[model samples]
Target: MTDLILCGCGGKMGAAVRELASAREDCRIVAGVDLACQNSGLHFPVYRALSEVNEAADCIIDFSHPSTLPSILNYCRTHPGTSAILCTTGYSEEQTADIRDAAEELPLFYSRNMSLGINLLIELAKKAEAVLGDAFDVEILEMHHNQKVDAPSGTALMIADAVNEVRENNMKYAYDRHSQRKKREKNEIGMHSVRGGTIVGEHQIIFAGRHEMITLSHSAQSKELFASGAVNAALFMKGKGPGLYSMSDLI
Candidate 1:
């Protein structure tokens, strides 16, 4: 059984994971670290600080804020052998670089979306981009709840990565339109965002050819799909090599 230490064990995402760990017996939720300093009703003890988690854990799955990236990376650096999963998004350029740096030290699984279905879409999208020619204009359309602050969700970016890898690597991320004078580029990826009333999430990738168009979509009816995917990642990563991996790697 693997020992799991969950970070951000108070928020909604954390709450869902907590429920999951409590229901499972193969792995023990030894400790929970959070800023709000929550006291969990689960069997394990909750600590306000990461340093207080004296137990040597097999993995630390972080679903916390991006603000904690530096500290989380530092902790993984000092611990040497402790594994980590980064579930936070909306990072700055430097923060993304920091994640790469941390990857050199610890086994890291960082993903914007932990949905396996979406990762499979990434694989399919990349293949489609190669098979479909320049005649097809690539576009990614995504929708989330109005509460979402990020314009382009991480899942949308994943899809962009998929398309960019196969094409001439000429995909542009356009969140909005400029003026009527604006002319779309040959390999530009038109990314559109839609916000609505409590939408779980929706992402669609369209490859438009002259007479026909192909679209690939993954819809999340509930957030549990992501939580389940994360769990599967944690279990899959039990004895893997030390390096940074994405949900696409799991798929």
Candidate 2:
């Protein structure tokens, strides 16, 4: 069995992961770290800080805030045989660098979004970019719940980057067109964000040409899909050597 430590156990995503892990026999949550420490009816011990936890966990699944990244990295540094699955988004550039650095010492699995279908969408976007070439203009549209703090969800950026990387010339991400009243540039990737209601998540990519348009989209019905992906990543990462891993790696 893979003994796990869950960070941000009090949050929605954390609770979903805990619920899914509870149903599985191969993994168990040994401890949880959360500022609220609300218990959320979990049988395992929950601490306000990672330093207070005494359990030795085989892996850690973090759905915590980016601010908690340092403490999580420190925990991994001190623990010899632990891997980490980071499912947090909206990290600053410095924090992102820290994650890459930490992976050199311990196994680390990181993803902007943890849904398997979303990752597949990224791959499909890349293939479409290659086949359609520069003749088609790409635009990514994403919608999340109003509670989400980040604009243009990370998954949208991931899809944009995947397509941009495959092109002969990297496409610039254009988040705003209102400020500069000008025609859309051919080498630019348009990104639009919508925040309203209780949308779990929705991402759609449109490839527009002169005559016809092709669209690819994915809608998440529930948060359980992301929770399931994180759990699967934790299982895949256990006992691995120091390295950086992504959802594509698991696929």
The candidate that wins on TM-score is: 2
lDDT of 2 by residue, 1-251 (tens): 99999999998998899899999999999999999867757889999998889999999999988888888888888998888899998888899898898888879999999999999999999899999989999999999999999988989988998998998557899999999888999999999999999999999999999999999999999999999999999999989999999998999
Candidate 1: regions farther than 4 A off = 40-42, 178-180, 239-241
Candidate 1 per-residue C-alpha lDDT over 90-140 given as tens digits, one digit per residue, 9 for 90 to 100: 777788888888787678898888888888888888888888878899899
Worst 10 residues of 1 by lDDT: 172-181
- How far is 196's C-alpha from truth in model 2 (Å)? 1.0
In angstroms, give how far residue 9 of model 1 lies from its true place: 1.3
Clashes of each: 0, 0
Q: TM-scores of all models?
A: 0.91, 0.97
lDDT of each: 0.80, 0.92
